[model samples]
Target: MNLTTKVNVTEEAEKLEKVLFSQKFWIDLGTTSLRIVLILIFAVLAVKIGKVIIRRLFRLKLKGPIRKSERRENTLLKLLENTISYVVYFSAILAVLTEFDIDVKGLLAGAGVLGLAVGFGAQSLVKDVITGFFILFEDQFSVGDYVKIGIAEGYVEEIGLRTTKIKSFTGEIYILPNGSIIQVVNYSLENSLAIVDVSIPFDVEVNRTEKLIEYYLTIVSQDKADFINKPKLIGAHDFTETEMIVRIIAETKPMRHYDCARLIGIGLKDYLEKEGITIPYPNLVTKSLTDV
Candidate 1:
């Protein structure tokens, strides 16, 4: 309303408008955005290139006469890939912060102090790291190994500094912290046993049944590459009121027992059908009320 107040308000509006329309403001924003984008791009490229390099290095090592264990190499490759990703992304974040005019040195110093203060309370984290180290060092289990830790049973997908990844047969992934893995049952370290039970009606001649199975066992492993040796017929294992159970044992490559067992069951069923040896099935009969 007053002349002096109107002039002051107009001056403040003009100054605000000028600042908003300044070329330097838009230019600075664009520059900072472009720098951040470039930093992120470089980080992604670094991770990809690092992974390729590591895989190539492993390939070269495998080609050598004195080669390392493939399982162990796979574990190391995964660990290295994760490490490179973490480092590259962390560096990229720092570069982006610098673009925003954040003091990198001061932030890092403060983080260091904070980390130290928090370390005492982060016992599980420390334990996880230490346990992971010992696991790798002792070669308890490697990536691709079939293992059971606690209730999680599957192939090891990755072993990291703080956690282990297990991919189950059902497509579920279990992420277990390293500190909690107290007992591990690794099935990949040795051969596996596959047991198949064939049930025959008690009326069938036991000697003839055994002979047929013996002949079948001789050729069972011939087509199966995973089988370490021919399957053996362990003879009549048990007897039921209607049928007799014969057992067959197979020695197969580690983690391949499942396939081998299934193949054995199918082949034996087919063989018995072709030989006219009928597997018993319960018979049902219905009587009319007049007959009863």
Candidate 2:
């Protein structure tokens, strides 16, 4: 109740106010913010440098005498880069949170539980990732490979842990989950058989036609490097009332079958016409009832 007591109490209150609103408090906040910014910058740099190192290492591995397919190398490089980025960014986030005195252990525990719950709901995603890993490891198909999956056929543009991107011949892009790929037909894996069917008039001599085709095939094999082997005349494939279907089979380079078949067809037509071989056309005969 005395004046001295009142002055001493007032001095204690002023000291408390100064401590609460001091420049040091603001400076500490600013320093924390700067640390966060620096951490973010380091994270970005880590990702960039990690990517560069990954690329160089893979490049050297690919160039070694052991010899790896380009597609396999590319898939691994992308997978490594993505994994490095995720890990580095996650660590950087934790570091930044620690700078602000946040409880990282509790956050990670919560995240783990949340991830478990999400995992139960996202079984398909996990399946897709597992399937993708198998696809890469087994070398089933790679980027730039022309493949047919179910009804979708196209050149593979990208293969990720969850999905695959394919660009079709008609310029349509298809994104399919890796788990959904049950069967894959890779057209680039081996030589393709070019089958060309030629229809001739039934009246034409079959034996002479066969010999003529075999002779022409020998010429084609010599001229076109795409042809892996000489064409084989498989005799008559089918018989119609007006014509006989002859089948020609040729082994050509992968993906060149269509072109080779087309060229063979043209050449056959030209040769048949030059040799006066008749190609059958349907002829319709109509009789009037009145005349009958």
Candidate 3:
């Protein structure tokens, strides 16, 4: 090789190395990193602010004269907060990818196709979301409501967009998809009726017993917080050979029917016994023949 040619080639190689290790290159890279960090910080702040705003708006709505339930308000607030967070985070991620020179449009197009495929495959999931929305919108049931859906009967612990968590009386938590809930029996919507039957010996005076029970029920209604109205003694309900059953019905607060019934039964028994009324019990007659 000639001397001048070799020198020129060496200078070109030095120029290339200088450009690669230039301060401008590091500065540009640092600027990009700072922009990504700023984007993430803004996204987080936006989500937080959005959530606060949503909660405040819902709180205002709750305090208004329209009078919405606490559970429904909380459910709506949470759903809005989640949606806001998701949107903000997604936008921030897209902006970061753009800073890195990634093709966000192409990525979004591919994601759209993939999402369509997933949506087709997950029809039940879509149904669940749709049903959940209607459940919230229509006020079908709320958190802490005692409900019976299919074979699952429990207090609703959590209601989400896709699933509901119910805690049974026996301490079992049932996670049920919203789409699976077709028929729901919400026991908390109205007052519950408590029916109690007291058995008395056939010899007892029916008219006097009924009057006494009615009086006692009036007293019970006054003392019990659960009672919505005074209980009524429904005369004689069932007749057996040994005893006659008198049925008492009481209107009580929701979920308090069982306790109200139990208290009424005990009070009736004590009162009846005090008034010299005999409560009948079944007798087992055993005949033994030893003479044969």
Candidate 4:
């Protein structure tokens, strides 16, 4: 055959193959749908059976190092479940295409290009997912943990693959991308310190106010079970024009900072009032026109 005739024949064959792949009928739908159904059944069976058997073995309480190891295993199980589901669904798609007798060779070559585009677009997204996985596996934080991560401080509400949900003290929900978290301050990991400031009028008897605070600090330290660390009456934090700022600080358990601060404030108030110590208020002194 002449070169021109051979080129024409190859073009026609390519066009025909395109047309065949694009043609979809009701019969094709039925076949593909059946395959999807079967694959879905297999995925469900795998999850149910795998969880029952694998998780059952972990049912008994583990102790010491074993308990910590078990938690890491749980993280792996969650990752496995996610990976397995996607794999099963992908296998179903390939099977469905094969049923139509479509050429998978060219599809694979096309897939490489498509996958390259997708991979580049999803780099940060994948990083978020991978970092989130490590966060969980390492037990960095858990739901209900009060943490400060990347300037967003709050209690962790939920932990997902790509993001973590934190409810801030201002009642705002912060959805933090895992990849963006550089510093993770897991306050839940250790005891928290509560710091409270109470300024009194400078003209008031400083000795009396100091004594009252000292008395109440003792009472608070002894009464509150949450007070793991004793309260410190930090004497005079600052001397302002209007008042002397007296700060009282206490260290308590993970979630007890708020309550600890409140208790100190209340106890100090009642004691100081009984002792006739004045809590400072902003003063508006008006200079008379005569003085001017």
State the displacement of the C-alpha of residue 85, model 3, in Å, after optimal TM-score superposition: 1.2
Mind giving the per-residue lDDT tens digits that candidate 1 earns over 1-292?
9999999999999999988899998898888899899989999999999999999999999999998767778767777888899999999999999998899999999999998888888989989999998898677898888889999999999988799999999999999999999999888877888777788898878788778878988888897799889988877778888888877787788878878888878888788778888764312122111222
lDDT for each residue of candidate 3 in 42-113, tens digit (9 for 90 to 100): 999999999888888887887888976676777677777888999999999999999999999999999999
- How good is model 2 by TM-score? 0.69
* Candidate 4 pairs with clashing backbones: none
Worst 10 residues of 1 by lDDT: 282-291
lDDT, candidate 3, equals 0.83
Backbone clash total, candidate 4: 0
Best by TM-score: 3
Cα RMSD of predicted structure 1:
10.6
lDDT of 1 at 201: 91
- Taken over the whole model, the C-alpha lDDT of each candidate is 0.83, 0.82, 0.83, 0.75
TM-score of each: 0.60, 0.69, 0.77, 0.55
lDDT (Cα, 0-100) at 161 in candidate 1? 77
| Rank list by TM-score | 3, 2, 1, 4
Clashing pairs in 2: none
How much is 292 displaced in model 4, in angstroms?
A: 50
TM-score of 3: 0.77
Local error of candidate 2 at residue 140 (angstroms): 3.0
